[model samples]
Target: MLATRLIFVLSVVIGWTTACTPSDNSTSDIFIIGDDGPAPAETSGYFINHFGLLTTNLEVMKHFYGNVLGMRLMFEVHVTPEYSVTYMGHAQGGRNGTGFQTGTEMYREKNNLAGLLELVQFNVTDDSLVASTKRTNTFGHVGLIVPDIQETQDYLENHGIEILKRYGEPIQDFTGLIPNAFGLGEYAGAHIAAKKALMEAQGVIGIQLLLMVADPDGNLVEIQQQEQPAGAV
Candidate 1:
């Protein structure tokens, strides 16, 4: 009887120790409590094609991005007398050996181009229908990478583009360009101050050079110099 009791105690101790020990499985290996089952198969061959912007003046935007920035016009569609859409990108031609064209042909070959800028315009006569001036309250800015930042800066200056902030300039110098820099509620004021402090710190540490310019529509555009990797093509 003593031998049987000792064996039972040992088995109970072993079972308790095993139950108390932490799992060796990884966090991902552990199944979620409410998960239905395995995740569905992911869709393939997906890529970000382009970013669109609604502009009050399409021709001016076109001239700034296409002529000044040197983005090739991939396609242009005049949907109606007052409504139009234009797609522009850095690429020149399609995969089918055909040059970029306007209207239907360009629409058909649009899938071949990536990183495009789509500008939409609606020339409505009603004051209520027109969009207000470009506001930084929602969308921040559009970023464009250039081969040489200095040359690009000089080119923009020559074209009379408003330089909100030049390369290496202190954030304090361009505070006016930021909306509500002076006036903000309590939380927003603190947030902006913190962001400004961080930006200044980064600038002092010699981070990547950045140039900011305002387009004809007063939309901010960030310009950065492209840095190629060691073995990049």
Candidate 2:
């Protein structure tokens, strides 16, 4: 029954382009896969619009992201006096690689989806709120790349956010050893144990970590720095 329904939908989607033609006398006809239509334009818009973090304290989350992280305050609106939404971003820009402007007020502008952070706060809560953390849950941390990691680290510390690890801190590399080791960058000649040791010694495995902070809701936030080449902004 499921397969029959799928075939009907597929036939409509592909404009009745099926591998086998349907017979007038047969009620059941098998569907064979066929080619799709022309591919859509490559310039279509597709990206993360905004990530929302629900919290109990609105002011704290706003301060941490807006004041401490230097994210421009896009705007703030109260769903009610007890509930509100705050939008923040690295810069004033539009979503989908359009309408980017530096030093513009977030509220004054619109459609800035490039790296927009949406923070939501509700004054009321019950026992229904499920607790989550990066360590214990599938939810991941937000990755931000700043020009100066150390400066951000200092700001976070001054605001009392814990520094989980220093930039370039080494961790055990457990990425399964690939067969074609030659093209695996630094892992070319290194075995599993050797790779682990080398990573331990160099203290650089994945991207450099500047700090890890928690929102008022205990959501982990990971911060990192961007490497700028000589004379490049």
Give the range of the ten consecutive residues with the poorest summed lDDT in model 1.
Answer: 127-136
Q: TM-score, each model?
A: 0.63, 0.56
lDDT (Cα, tens digit) per residue for candidate 2, span 41-79: 784666566888777777877787767766767777898
Winning candidate number (lDDT): 1
User: What's the CA error at residue 130 for candidate 2, in Å?
Assistant: 5.2
lDDT for each residue of candidate 1 in 1-233, tens digit (9 for 90 to 100): 97875665565545545655568733331112466664555845565678787777888889998788767676778999998888887643322223654545556766866667889888884543221123225555667877788888899999988777787564552234533222222324457645544443443233336778766666667777786333221
lDDT of each: 0.61, 0.56
Off by over 4 Å in 1: 1-41, 92-108, 125-134, 179-187, 190-196, 204-208, 228-233
Error of 2 at 227 (Å): 1.3
Q: How close is candidate 2 to the true structure, as a TM-score?
A: 0.56
Models, CA RMSD each:
16.0, 16.3
